[model samples]
Target: MTTLTRARTGPFAADYAALKAAAWLTPARERAWERLQEAASPSERRGNERWKYTDVRPLTSVPYRLAHAGALPGLAEVKKIAPWDDAWTTLTFVDGHFAPALSTEPTGRVAAGRLATATASVQSLLEARLAKVQAIDEEYFTLLNTAFLSDGAYVHVPDNAVEERAVHLLFIASPATSPRVAHPRTLVIAGKNSQSKFVESYVSLADSDQHFSNAVTEFFLDDGAQVEHYRILAENEKSHHIGNTRVHHMANSRFNSISFAIGPAIGRNDHHALIDGPGAETNLSGLYMTTNGQHMDNNISVNHEKPHGTSRQYYKGILAGKSRAVFSGIVVVKPGADKTFADQKDLNLLLSPGAEVDTKPSLEIFADDVKCFHGATAGHVDLDTLYYMRSRGIGLEAATQMLIRGFAAEVVERIKLPALARYVEGVTEKMLPEFRLEVPK
Candidate 1:
C-alpha cells in the first residue's frame, strides 16, 4: 500500500485540525500525527492484496464532525443496550468521552478505570501503556487512533492479583445532526501471574445515524498472566466501524479471545496477537454475520517469536442478501521458534445469490520443525439436509435458521463466561432472521 499524505487522508481532514488543537496533546500523539500523514492511502487499496477484497472507500470519503461530550441517553437506556450488570467493574464512554455518572467503581482493586478523577496509580498505568504499545505498530488505522486519541478506560490488574469479576468497557455512538466520528481507546495491563476477563463492546444509540467509531484496544499480558477477552461490534446499519485490537503475550502467559461482528453498514476490524516469549498460548475465534447490503471485514493474526508457543485461530461467517464479508486469518512462526504449534481456519456460508465472501487462512513458518496448518472454505448449505429438515415438518425458514445457528454455534459456544454468552446469544439470535436463504422454487 502506498503511504498517504496530508490531503490523501480525505475523511479525517475536516476534523484533523480540531483534534490537534486539544489542550491535552502529548508527544506521542504528535508523533502519531506525523505517522498518520504517511500511513496507508485507500486510493491504492485495490492493488494491495490485503485490501483487494474489501473496498474502504466508504470509510475514506465521508467528512466527519468530531464527537464531543454531547447529549447522551440516561443510564436506564444504556442498560437496555449493554445489559451487563454483574460486571466486576464497568466503565462507559459515549462518543469516546468518559461518562462517569454512568460508570461504577471497583470495590476491591487498586484501580479499575482511568477517569479524569482516576486514582494516581491508575493514571500512571494509562500514561505508560496507551501510546507506548509497539506490538502491532504502524498500520493506517492504528496511527489514526493515536493521532486523534482522547480519554480512555484503562484497566490495570496488579501483579498476582486475581480479579474475580469481569471488566466491561462499553462504548456507545450517540446520534448526531451531521456525520461524526470518535477515537475510543482501551488499554488493559495484566500484571505478572494476574488473571482477568475483559469485554469491549460497541453499539449505537441511534438506529440509522451516520457515525464512525474508530476504536483501538491493547492488552499487555505479563509473564504467567491470563486474560480472557471478548469483543463485540453491533452498530446501526447506517454507521461504520473500524477498529484495531493488539495483544502482547510474554513468557508463560495465556490469552483467550472471542470476537463477534454482527453490525454496521461497513466495518473493518484487525486483531493481532504477538507471542513475544516462550510457553505463551493464544486462542482466538471470531464470527461475523451480515445481511442486506452491509459489508464486514475481519483480519486476524498470531505471531510467534519464541519457541514452545501454541496458538489457535477459528473464524466463521454467514452472508445473506447482497451483503459482503472478508476473513483473513494468519499464523507466523519466526526462525528458531521451534516447537511452535499453530493452526487457523476460516469458514463462510452464503445464503443468497447476491451474497459474497472472500476468505484467506495462511501460515508462514520460518522454523522447519514447527507444526503449522491453515485452511479456508466458502460454500452454501447442503440441499439434502435442508430438504430432510422440511420433510420432518419443519418450516423452511425455521429449518434454515436452525442450520445457521448450528453452523455458528462452534464459535459462540467458545464463550466461557455464562452471562456474556447469554447476552451474545440474544444479540446473535435477533439477527438470525436476516440470514434466511433465498430458496428458489
Candidate 2:
C-alpha cells in the first residue's frame, strides 16, 4: 500500500495553521495531519482511483474557511429534524462537533457522545478500532478528513444488549462566512446478540458557499448482532461531499445499509463490507437523484471470507440535465469461502439527452462451491411502458412519473423503518417530478 504524505505548505497554509491551533486536537488527529502533509495537492480532472469518477476541481479552486465551533446550531433547531417517534434517541453535531445539549443518550445498554468528552475507558475502545477497518492510504479526501477532524459522535452497544429504539445522528454544516469544511467521523461497535438501527443525516445551510464535507464511518458487528444503517446526504448544491463507510461482520451477524443522495455539487461514496465469519449476511441498497451539473458516484466492494455467508446489493440513480452518475460494485469470494451466495445489480435512468452514466458490476469467486452474480444497466425511460400507460387513460406526464416512482420504489420500499421510508419516498417524489413526470392520483 502506498502511504500518502501531508502537504508542507501551500494554499491551505492558513487552514493548516488554524487546525493546529484548534483546542480539540488529539494524537490520532495529529497523525492524520502529518499524513496529509505528505500527500500531493488535488487537481482538476485528476484520474486517481478515488477521484476518477468525480472531479473535485471546483472544491479545490476555492479556499474554505474553518467553521467556528462556537457558532454551532441551537437545541431547538436540532430537534426540528428529530424522528417523530419518541422511542428513538437523537444526537446532533454542528460544524463537525457533537452537541450534547441536543442529544439523548439511551439508558445503560449503550453509550453515545462526542469523542472529546468520552471517558478514558470509552476512548480506549475507540482507539483500538478507529481506522482499523478501512484503508485510508490511497484516498486523499479521507486523508484530509483525518487531518482536520476535531470531534464527532461515537456509539457503542454492549454484548447481548438490545435497544428498542433507533439511534439518530444529524450533522449540520453551518458557515457564517466564506467557504467551510467539516470532517465528521463516526464509529459504531455492536456486540454479540445485540440489535440496533442507526440513521445519519448530512445537511448544509448555504448552497453557494463552496463548502466541502468529508465524512468516514466504521462499523464492527459481533456474532448474532443485527444492524441497520441509513445515510441521507442533502448538502448544499454547491458543496462537495466525499464519504467512506466500512463494515465488518462476524459469525451470524447481519448488516444492512441504505444510502440516499439528494444534494451536492459533487458526491462520491465508497462502501465496503467484509463477511469474515460463517453465517454472516449483508444487504446494501442506495438511491441517488442528480440534476443540473451535479455529479454522483457510488463504489462498493463486498468480500466473502468464510463459508455460508450471503450478501446482496442494489443501487439506482436518476440523472437529468447535464448531471452524471457512476456505480461500480464488486463481490469477491475467497478460496475457502464455500457456499457463499452474493448478488449485485445497478440500474441508471437518464432523463436528459446530455445526462451520462457509467456502471460496472463484477463478481470474483475463487471457491467452486460459491454462487455469485452481477449486472448493470443504463438507459432512458421505456417509451413502451409510457405509451401503454397512456393508452390506459393515464396522461403522458403521469405515466412517466409512475414509471420513475416504480423504479425508485423497488429500493425505497425495502427500507424497514416506516417513517424513514416515507421520508425518502417523499424526497424522491419531489425530485422526480421535475423531469417532466406526471403525478398519478
Candidate 3:
C-alpha cells in the first residue's frame, strides 16, 4: 500500500490563519481548529480501523484549495434542480455558500438561514447541541469538518409549531478553477411538541473536475418533538464526499432518518444519535448503490442513556462491477437504561463477480431487562428465486435485475415520502444493467 504525505503549510493551514484574521473565528470554531491541527496530519491508513476497507490516500496526496466567495459564476441553468416542489421551503447552497437568490422563503414559525448569519438564539441553540450527541475524538474527518466550517444551513422550529411541509436543503458542489474543498455544517433545533420534516441533498453541477465535500449536521429534538430527516448524496463520480450527522433526542422525542448514497469515487458517511431522556424513539434506514470503481462506507451508532427508549436500524446496499461497500452499525444500552428495545439489520446484495461488501452490526447492553438484537448478511442474489422467475418465460438476465430491485425496494418502501421513494426507485432502475435479455426492446 502506498502512503500519502501532506505538506504542513498547505491550503488548510493557510485557511486557518486567513479565517482567523478575517474574523471568521468563533470560540467553538477556534476549539475545533486546534483539535484539527493535532490530528489532521497525513499518516499510514493501515492502523485506523475506520480506514481499513477504504483507501483515502488520495485525500492527502493532492493539495486542494478551499472554496472562496464568488468562486462559482452566475449560472441560470444550475439553479433549476430542486428535490422538492414549491410546496416545500427550500434552501440552496452552491459550493457550500448560501445562495439566497436561488432559495425560497420560509413560512410560519421557522427560523431558517445560514449558520453564520442566524439569529443569536439560533446560534445559542447550536452551541448548546452541536457536539452534545457525538464528541469529536479520533475522527479526523469530523474534526476537519468542524475546523473548516463556514456557511451552511441553520433551522429552528419553535414550540408547538407543526410544519405542514418539509424543509429542503440542497448543497451543490461545482468545479472550481482548481481542485477545491467545502466544509458545510447544518444545525436543526426542534422545540418541545414541534413537528417538521427536513431533506438534505448533496449533488454536483459539473461532471468532470475532482472536488471534495466534507459536511456535518447536528439535530436537537426537545421533549415531545418529532422530526423526519432525509439525506441523499449524488455527487460526481470523480469527487470525494464525507458526511457526518449527530442527533440528540430528548424525552418522548421522535427522530426518523433515511439516507441514500449513489455517487462519488469515494464516499463515507458517519451518523450517531443519542437518546438522552426517557421514552425517546429513533428509526434509521439507508441504502447505497455503487457501480464501476466507486467505493462507499456507512457508519452508524446509537446510544440509549435512558429507559423505555426504542430504536430500529436497517440498511441495504447493491454493489455492481468492481465497486465496494461497507456498513457498520452499533447500538449501545447504557446502565439504568432498562426496558430499552433495539433491533438492527444490515443486508447487501452483490450483482457482479467482482462486487464486494463488508457489513458489521453490534449491540452492547449494560442494563438488565433490555431487549437488543443485531444481524448482518452479505451475499449474491438468490439463485433459486431467479430460477423461478426465469422458468416463467422471463429471461435470466431480466429476472436477476428484478430480484435485485425487490431486494432494494424493501428499504425504499420504508421511506414515508411518496415522491422521494419513487425518485429512489427511478435511480435504482437506472443503476441496473440494461440487458435486452429477449424480454424488453
Candidate 4:
C-alpha cells in the first residue's frame, strides 16, 4: 500500500492564500478566511468528543488544489449516476462548477439556480447564512469550504408554496491526476408554511489516484414548513469525501433526513440539526455500506432547544472485507427544553471476521420531563438464516446478498417518496455485486 506524504507546512497552507474573491460571495468568503486563518488544523484536533475513532491526517496531508471546470460530462454519463425523473428538477455540478448546460432549472413558485444568477434577495440571504449554521471557527473543513467557496447553487421556496416536484442537486467529482479538492456549497431557504422535497447526491466520474471533495449543505425551515431531504454519497476507494450538513427547524416544522453511503477511502459525514421551536419534529436515518479497506465515519447530533420537540436518529450499516466503520451519535436536550422526545439507535452487521465497527450512541439531557434514549449493537450474519436460505435453493453468495439487503430494508423503507425509494434500491442493488464478500467464521 502506498502512503501519502505528510505536508511539510501546516495543512492547507498554500491553498488558503490562493482563494480569489467571487462576484457576490466575496464578503462571506472573506469572513470565512479571516476565521479559518485562526483555526487549528485537523491534526491538532485530538479528543473523543470531536476527533475520536477517525484519523484524517492522510486526507489533509495531500497538498490540495481547488478543482477548475473540466470537460462537461455527457448526459448519458451523468444519468448513469442519477437517473432522470420527470417529477424532479435537476442541478448538476462538475468538479465544483455549476454545469448549466446539463441541468434543469427549478420551476414553479421557486427561485433556484447558480449563485451568480441569484436575485438580490437570494444573494443577500446567502451572504448572511453561508457559514451561519456551522460556525467557521468550529470545524476545519466547513471553514475551509466558505474560505475557498467558489461556485455552487441556491434555492428559495416561497411561503405557502408547494414545490410540486422534488429538487435534485447532483455534484459529480471528475477524475484528476493530482490530489485535487472541490468545495461545493448548497443553501436552501424554506419560507413559512412552505413544503418541499430535496435530493442531494455526490458521485465520482471514476476512481482517481488522489482526490478530495469537501461539501457543505445548509437548510433552514421556517414555521409550519416541511422538508424531506435525501442524501446519497458514492465516490471510490482512492478518493476522500467529507460531507457537512446542517438543518434548522422552526415552530410546527418537520424535517425528514434519509441518507445512503458507499465508496471513498475515508468518507466522513457530519450531520447536525437544531430543533429550536415547539411542535417541531425531525426524523433522521441513514444506511452505509463499506467494503475492501475503505473507512467510513458518521457523526450525528440533534439538539433540542425548545419544548415539545421530537427527533429520532436511526442508522444501520453493512460491512464486508476488512473495512472499518464508526458511528458516534448524541442527542442533547438543553435545560428549559422540557417535553422533548428523542430516540437513537445504531446497528451494524459484519460479513467478514476482519471487518470491524465502533458504535457509540448516547444522550445528554439537562431538561426535566423529557424522554431520551440510545442503543447500539454490532454482530455478524446469522448462520441459521443462511441455512434456511440454502434449503430454499439459494446460492451462498446470493443468499448473503439477500440478507444484507434485508438488513438495510428498515432504513430504505422509511423513505416516504415511492419513486425515490425505488431508485435508491436500484442503486443499492448495483453496488451489492462489488462487495468483497467473505463468509463469517
**Better structure of 1 and 4 per lDDT:** 4
Candidate 4: clashing pairs of residues: none
Output the worst ten-in-a-row residue range by lDDT, candidate 1. Answer: 1-10
**Candidate 3 displacement at residue 277 in angstroms:** 0.8
RMSD, one per candidate, in order: 2.1, 3.5, 3.8, 3.6
Q: Compute each candidate's TM-score over C-alphas.
A: 0.94, 0.90, 0.91, 0.94
Question: What is the C-alpha lDDT profile of model 2 across 1-441, one tens digit per residue?
Answer: 333233333665577666642243466666766777667655424445545676666777767666667665665554443333445677777777767676776665777877667777887887787766756653566676766666777789999988767888777877546777778888898999898899988877555666777888889898999998889888877888888888988999999898988789888878989998999999999998888889898989899989999999999998888889889888999989999999999999877777888888888889878888888888887777878999999988788778778878887887878878776776677666666532223
C-alpha-based local distance difference test score of model 1: 0.82
Supply candidate 2's per-residue lDDT for 98.
68
Per-residue alpha-carbon lDDT of model 1 for 1-441, expressed as tens digits? 444433365566666666643334356677777877766664355456666777777777877768888986898888676647655478889998888777888765535765344566556566677666554347677787777765677778889988778888999998888898888888888999998888889988888799999888988899999998899898889898888888888999999988888889989878888888899999988899999999999888888989999999888999999999988888889998899999998899889888988888888889868888888888887889999999999988999999898998999998877877887889878888878888555
Residue 267 in model 4: lDDT: 92
* lDDT for each residue of candidate 4 in 1-441, tens digit (9 for 90 to 100): 222222233445576667555678777777766766566555544443466677787787778788877899888877776645766888888888889887886789877888766778777876776667744346667877877777788888889998868888888888787778888889988899898988898888876567888999998888999998999887777888999999888898999999998888899988999887888899989999998888899999888888999999999999988899999998999998899999999999998898999999989999999988889989888888899999999988899889988999999998877767877888889888866457744
Between the candidate structures 2 and 3, which one is better when assessed by TM-score? Answer: 3
User: In angstroms, how far off is 60's CA in candidate 4?
Assistant: 0.9
Task: Please write out the lDDT profile of model 3 over residues 12-124, one tens digit for every residue.
Answer: 78776666321332666677666665564433464556566777777656687787767553535543333555676888888878888768899878878887776666666
Clashing pairs in 3: none
- The better candidate by lDDT, 2 or 4, is 4
Runs in model 1 with CA error above 4 Å?
1-7, 10-14, 20-25, 115-124, 135-137
lDDT of 2 at 45: 42
TM-score of structure candidate 3: 0.91
Error of 3 at 146 (Å): 1.9
Q: How many residue pairs clash (N, CA or C atoms closer than 3 angstroms) in each of the candidate models, in the order given?
A: 0, 12, 0, 0
